[model samples]
Target: MTETFVHPRAEYIDTRQPPPPPQPPPPGLAPPTSPPYITSGTEECESRWEAGAAMTEWEEKEVEEEEEEEEEEEEENS
Candidate 1:
């Protein structure tokens, strides 16, 4: 008659206790949300006058497509 088996013991972590003091935001949590674009000054002078009237209507449609490609190269060189 011979039976012997017991091995389970390892837990004494007390690392000089001092790391637990930051946990207080769980009571219907709600306290941090406010900053969604809030610019002023007449909305920055109407977004710089609508970006200078969209860059002066894109430089007047590139000077009316370079004056209709110089009047279609002067009517295909007459």
Candidate 2:
């Protein structure tokens, strides 16, 4: 004949109940409307490059104008 024994302090968990739902954020805080950052596309890169080139041309023109004005002032003072 064989004999079986069980532990007296073992506990059993109930699996019938569902887990609790997630909590919502407090007042005055809202979710983001858009992503934190964006990955530039080919069109966007081209546009940015064109803008930079235009700005460089504008700055060169401004420098030339300032140099011409300085030369005029020097001629007037001579």
Candidate 3:
């Protein structure tokens, strides 16, 4: 390696869904009795491909508009 310094460059990313609607806390939710996030066996993979998912311009615009309308409605009600 010519230079030993490591650098990172970031890029902007957009999602298809309008960050899923937040759910209100349940009056009384039960806790799971078992442990979670324990993967028995798995393989290292090219996770980057997921971010490359395709989204048409129309779909993106539709979601953006829907989100905006929802925000406007909430603001008016509040």
Q: Provide TM-scores for the models.
A: 0.18, 0.31, 0.32
Q: lDDT of each model, Cα atoms only?
A: 0.65, 0.64, 0.57
User: Which of 2 and 3 is ahead in lDDT?
Assistant: 2
Q: What's the residue-level lDDT of 3 in candidate 3? A: 82
lDDT, candidate 1, 1-78, per-residue tens: 887654444455567978899887788978545345655434544455677744356555765787899999999999
Consecutive 10-residue window with the lowest summed lDDT within model 2: 38-47
Assess the local accuracy of residue 22 in candidate 2 as a C-alpha lDDT between 0 and 100: 63
Task: Give the Cα RMSD of candidate 3.
Answer: 21.9
- Which pairs of residues clash in candidate 2, taking residues 3 or more apart in a chain or in different chains? none
How are the candidates ranked when ordered by lDDT, highest leading?
A: 1, 2, 3
Clashing pairs in 3: none
Where is model 1 more than 4 Å wrong at Cα? 1-57, 64-68, 75-77
In the range 1-78, model 2's lDDT, one tens digit per residue, is 887676665556665878779667667868544444656443444556677744456655765787999999999999
Q: Number of clashing residue pairs in every model?
A: 0, 0, 0
Candidate 3 per-residue lDDT, tens place, 1-78, comes to 598664553444554677878676677966543355534311111222245755567656765787999999999999
Top-TM-score candidate index: 3
